[model samples]
Target: MNENVSFYRDTWAEINLDAIEYNVKSMVEHLGGEGTVIAVVKANAYGHGDYEVACAALEAGADMLAVAFVDEAISLREKGMKVPILVLGASRPEDVQVSIDYDITLTAISLEWVKKAEQFAKEGVLQFHIKLDTGMGRLGITEKEELDELIQFAADSSSLSVRGIFTHFAAADELESDYTDCQFAAFKKLLGGISNKEWLIHCANSAAGLRFKDRIFNTVRLGIAMYGLSPSKEMNKELPYSLQEALSLHTKIVHVKKLPKGGKVSYGATYTAQEDEWIGTLPVGYADGWLRQLKESEVIAGGKRVQIIGRICMDQCMIRLPEKMPEGTKVTLIGRQAEEYIPIDEIADRLETINYEIPCILSARVPRMFLRNKSIMEVRNPIIQSHSASKG
Candidate 1:
């Protein structure tokens, strides 16, 4: 651990780079000469740190990287990553030149956007992928004629190169395959007779890649599954291989007190002790991405499950301790402590959201400590870094 990286607040997210590497390798092996894996590192690799995750994925045999926008691609480029990066979202006309300069691939959603981008590219070829809106009503060209026009326009443009074509899956995680089949069929129809071997034609995301193995696309965009999370609860059991979770949240008790019978806890006094009990205050709350709705959730302390009591506050929450635990005792929020573990799925279920949202929702205020080979490799404390830089 870095000397500057102190556990001062005792709340931080631990990122296991080894698990990430393993997951990517497993996915790549599963592809087994069928296709390549485009590791999706968007939204900071689902809030597990993009640069770190990208490096791990690439080291583990990922063929390419995908982000939500051009800025993300530029960020990785600035960090000296030279892998093929594709922006999966629409880019501003003004920012088209940046993509060209960085050799980053942008997604061409419309002919109007493509024509506008041509105006911005002063020199060199602007590489991009044509996004086909097969079923995902999001960004992409839906009509076949529009797609044809875009392809012709790109071919005519001296500064544009159509490097790939792809589409999004609307519900590939679901049990029913009718909609996915229709989407894949439409994608195939859209690319009908365009047999340019160099053009990358892909449609499978993490869900589609695992579930629909019969339909092999040239590339699979590994997203949620790359982070050791299932696409959905229903699809968990059907995974071809087991996934290892890469992120774990932890904090320590900052304060401890013995409350008498009928004593209230937290704001609104929603929880009251029926008998004399020990209470421990954690330094994590909704502000740290531990949402207030998790008040009913349990955390591990001293190898025991402790119930979070009362309303969760902005910077603190009270947990009913089984015994008088001293301040600074470790608490496991979303990982294994001793023999018990609190999974992200459980937290997502309580929040009525998907597992993807759980980690992404974690606030930047909480520091992230990266681990490799069961050892701490780097600790990123934004708050501490900002404070130290201000002094320097």
Candidate 2:
């Protein structure tokens, strides 16, 4: 089903557009008529083909799209996406005009940034959201006096339009909701008399949006959950709705060899065969975002779990096979195989990280093959595209 089947390498990531659409629709319906969903497509939709995911999200009722920087928003624009995009990070003063030119929304982190951006505003109105650092203490206005000043300045500037004001929840995904409650209280106190109707006021990421639905907010930035990942493992039990995982990492065994007892495999000579064993070399490694730390992890082969032995290399890794599997055997790093499964959460648990980091770290070296209805809809191979373009 892959149109570029002959071009890309054996290792690739399969993205399910249907699953993405389902997740988005579930989030919207779960909101229960309170707020709109802003599909957070930053980090290339958390490294799952941004444009494709964005299109699927919009089709599923997402009200807007949000990215981390200006260039990311521009990329969506270049792909003919006209949805309102809010850049979540601070925009450089000099590049404010570029955001304005693209009709993108910028985040006003501080009164100083607002003042600086006002000076750069040349012609049309620039829309932005005021970020409040209620408790996160990462970005946004932290002081009440500063918030007042910024509100006044934005009101006075004819070239600037304040479309929304938002804060981030620090512990919304934890079992304890006390901290989230305090953060919401602080956000309300900071708002004072600023009517929510006047501007879009949001404070919920995926976790808070689901756990604290009673909180009054007009917009919810759907990030991890939109891609069918729980914000935290502990909170999985409390989820109100089911989420379908949309990503799967797969590769074919390119080489297979039988090693006798006392044989060592890969770098460091770390893995020594206890007895005669069949070893398969996978065409995926740290370079492809399969971190070396996953050397002890497991992959599915022959519909069974196989131990990954030896240190993962820059471009390859080895998996101990159940038997002498034939070459081109399908290996699943993060997906289902017959009766066995390797979830992203399992990989995250092994790596001592969160589920969000798992997919986001998958390098572009592994091309993305998007599927719908169990058939390849499109293939994005940067290596092949670059080579073809150069030749042209």
Candidate 3:
């Protein structure tokens, strides 16, 4: 299945494309004909593999794809993604031509950005979605006067085409946020000036989409929830339906050794065997996104959970095996093995971070093996590709 590049490492992330499709379909069903779903495949689909996840989302009836910036949109375009790709972040006014050339939609956060972009819009239609800063305080028009000027300018420009207007909630993850209520009220007041009611209006991210159906106007941006992750731990209880997690981290035990009683393991000699114990070396470490902070974490081996012992090295770590497991035995850093399972949330807990940050932090050196219909669909090995490109 992995014929293109011979993988030289034992550790890789397995991405289930079916799970991605399932999550999208679940969201579509949850919306129940309420609005269009905008699949947020930014940060390489939260590091699940962008192109692969985008294709899966589209296949599951996502109306459009959203990315954080223009380069991300361009990457999807380069991969032949034909569906509408919206750049949710601010872009340089000079980059207007590139968006037009690639058929990517740009976000107009302010009149200043719009006027600067107008200079670059010598020719070709440039589509835009006006962003309103209701409560996020990140970008967009905060006042009615700014909104009116931006709308009027776009309506007057020969090259500019304003397709939509939207805002973001600062605390949609919290079900009881008075701030979210005020933000929606502000967004509605701003919407009063715009005559075009058909413009794609959206104000809901994953959390809002799942909890507040009234706020999701015509479109919902599915980001964290699209990857089968809850928008926040607190919102997990309110999920209308269950989501299928798609990624699993795996590696193989490369070396096994018997540690004498009181013998130490790894660089700092932090882990000592109270009794004679079997230790297995895994070819995964901090350099591969397996941070040293996870040295105390447990991994699934031989159908049981085993502790990762010692200070995690740059390229390797040691685990205390229950017995003398043979070299090349399977080890699951994340996912199910027999009855034992290690969710990404557990890894996140150990690192004192969110589950969304886990996969995004996985280094490029780790290959992503995409699975579809329970078979290997494709393998993306950046290391091998770089090597091949250098030789060429």
Model 1 vs. true fold: TM:
0.97
How are the candidates ranked when ordered by lDDT, highest leading? 3, 2, 1
In the predicted model 3, the residue pairs found to clash are none
Residue pairs in candidate 2 whose N, alpha carbon or C atoms collide under 3 angstroms: none
Which regions in candidate 2 have their CA more than 4 angstroms from the true location?
1-3, 196-198, 389-392
Candidate ordering by TM-score (highest first): 3, 2, 1
Off by over 4 Å in 1: 1-7, 387-392
Per-residue lDDT tens digits of candidate 3, residues 1-392?
24564588889999999989999999899889889999999999998999999999999989999999999999999989999999999999999999999999999999999999999987798999999999899999998998898888888989999999999988998876789999999999999856786789999999889998889989999999888888888887888999888999999999999999999998978888999999999999998999999987899998999999999999999999989999989999988889998988989999999999999999988999999987888889888889998999
TM-score of each: 0.97, 0.97, 0.97
For candidate 2, the per-residue lDDT at 175 reads: 85
**lDDT head-to-head 1 vs 3, winner:** 3
What lDDT does candidate 1 reach at residue 168? 92
- Give one digit per residue, the lDDT tens place, for model 1 in 1-392: 24667657789999999999999888888888788889999998999999999999999999999999888999899989999999998899889888899999999999999999999999788999999999889889888899889999999889999999999989999985689889988988988868788988889899988888766568899999999999988898899999999999999999999999999999998898999999999989899899999987899999999999999999999999988998889899998989999989989999999999999999889888999998888887778778998999
For every candidate structure, what is the RMSD over all alpha carbons to the true structure, in angstroms? 1.5, 1.4, 1.3
| lDDT values for all models | 0.90, 0.91, 0.91
